[model samples]
Target: MHDERLANLLGAMALAIHDVMLPAVVDSSGVGVSASAALVVLGAHPGLSVSELGRRLGLSQPAAARMVDSLQEQGLVTRRKGTGRVVHVGSTRRGREATRRLLAARSAQLVDVLGSLTARQKQQLEPLLGTLLTALYRQIGDAERVCRLCHRSCCVQDALCPVGQAERSLAGG
Candidate 1:
């Protein structure tokens, strides 16, 4: 019961932080949350087919197309030719600019948060994050931890994150 309560509180805290911080970083601009997520996926894997992009972003193909459609209409993304005559989705100049602004806004928010953390607190946080991540992985398992990664790219590169575990499994590490 204690473990469950702890996990639940952690989940709630994560969601609460996201609720507060995401709007500070990304603009809604009448575009839906799914659309914003699509931009992030496209930024990671530019030139992915709508189908492939859907697979990566875990959306249905048609849903991915609709997201692309909105982005295209806004002149934020475009399609280019690919091998085997497949077309791929990528960000347009405007799209990159918008993404840049979004990232800058996010960075600013993060800076504000960081300013509140003392040097000693941050230093101690490093080890504590590892323990928390290990517990998170143990509770959630690899599939939910990676594919449904709550913070997406932020967790992908960290050595203690699930992607690292997935990669280790792939490489026999």
Candidate 2:
């Protein structure tokens, strides 16, 4: 039976996720998610070129350039040019540290959120979550290689949200 309880649970789950994911989300100053995404790619690749970073983050050249400029100004990133418009951007020590802190905080938040779930609940939920997530992603992924291509908000929110903390409702493995 389609119950009100299910709807309330879903709404609560959505709100909780939005709260936990706030730190990791890098919304642009006057930009969109694309600029923030570029930072992740650049941070991981370190010395990737502007063009390469742009492609990796799925941003236009102008957008990537703007992101790089903002990052450089913020001191979270730096860039160097080799030759013929070959520019490389790498994360600053500050950026790497920030990433670490953010990840750790998020992990801690998740731990606190699920502190009460019994072992059985987790066991039941993991598999169901994994399967459902896989199916959802598959359905969405089949549409486009890049998420920004999809206007659907979940394209940005779902994966980043720490839904694992809600393992009790999950019907895990």
Report the number of the highest-lDDT candidate: 1
State the displacement of the C-alpha of residue 154, model 2, in Å, after optimal TM-score superposition: 22
Predicted candidate 1 versus true structure: per-residue lDDT over 65-134, tens digit per residue: 8888888999888988788857699987777666655655655665576677899998787667666665
Task: State every prediction's TM-score relative to the real structure.
Answer: 0.70, 0.59
Q: lDDT by residue for model 2 over 1-173, one digit each (tens)?
A: 47798769868986986576544443222223455455445444579888777776656788788888987887778898878989888878876665454444444565666777888988787666656655554554422223322223332354432222223234352
Query: lDDT at 122 for candidate 2?
Result: 80
Cα RMSD for candidate 2? 9.2
RMSD of 1: 4.3
Clashing pairs in 1: none
TM-score of 2: 0.59
In candidate 2, position 61 carries an lDDT of 83
